[model samples]
Target: MFGILVSAFNVVLGFVMRSVIAKFFAYFVMWFITTEFVSVLQSAGILPTASALAGAFGSIGSDVWYFMDLCSFSFGAPLVISAYATRFIIRRIPVIG
Candidate 1:
């Protein structure tokens, strides 16, 4: 009974650990690739920087800026981008998809 219990525990633990490690590795790779891709786009002037975004926001009327600030668009933009990126990456992974 004791041997069986230990074996079962080991199996469960191994499965959990494997899952955790796989997910961590996948997310890390996704993040690294996303970072590099964003860097290249920014360098190429295809993507605007934070300061440029802020400047554009400033140029807009105060009411519009206030609405944006209230809606927290600055925080939402990156979050939405990350969500889409994760979805894209996951779809590319056969095992997960």
Candidate 2:
């Protein structure tokens, strides 16, 4: 009975560790790729800078500009892109999808 319990515990621990490591690796890869992609976009001038966004919002009105600043397009663009990228990647992975 003690041997059986020890075997079961080892099996469960191994499975948990594998799951945690795989998830951590996946998250790290996704983050690295997303940041690189976002940086490339920014360098290419496809994505505007925070100051540029603020400047554009300046003419709109204080209320609207304040709202824009609060929402923060510069920050949001990467977040939105990363979400789609993650979804696309997950769907492409046959085992995970």
Candidate 3:
């Protein structure tokens, strides 16, 4: 009964997770595409706005900060996700008798 319960739980968890991931990625990709489109539009514009002017004000420190933030998130997010997924996969697989 315990084995059955554990197996059932893994199956249910995997199925629900897959469904949620599918939906989440669908919306996520759509959002990324739209944001990229908007960025392209902004770049194509001839005149700059307040945001553009303000963005130009910073010196080396802000540039370093920007790079650091980008690097931290770019590397951190995927590494954390992969590690967490590895743990999840390990947990989900049952040991052979």
lDDT of 3 by residue, 27-56 (tens): 787666655654664688843566764576
Candidates' C-alpha lDDT: 0.77, 0.75, 0.65
**In candidate 2, what are the lDDT values of residues 3-82, reduced to their tens digit?**
99999999999988899888998888777776676667679997657798568656787687577678896588679867
Q: Please, what are the lDDT tens digits per residue for candidate 1 over residues 33-72?
A: 7667666756998655779867766778878878988999
Instruction: Point to the candidate with the largest TM-score.
Output: 2
Better of 1 and 3 by TM-score: 1
Residue 79 Cα positional deviation in candidate 1, in Å, after optimal superposition: 10
Off by over 4 Å in 1: 49-97
Q: What shift in Å separates residue 96 of candidate 1 from its native position after superposition?
A: 11
In model 1, what is the error at residue 30, expressed in angstroms? 0.8
Model 3 misplaced stretches (Cα beyond 4 Å)? 46-97
TM-score of 3: 0.41
- How many residue pairs collide in each prediction? 0, 0, 0
Model 1, residue 71: C-alpha shift (Å)? 11
TM-score quality measure for candidate 2: 0.49
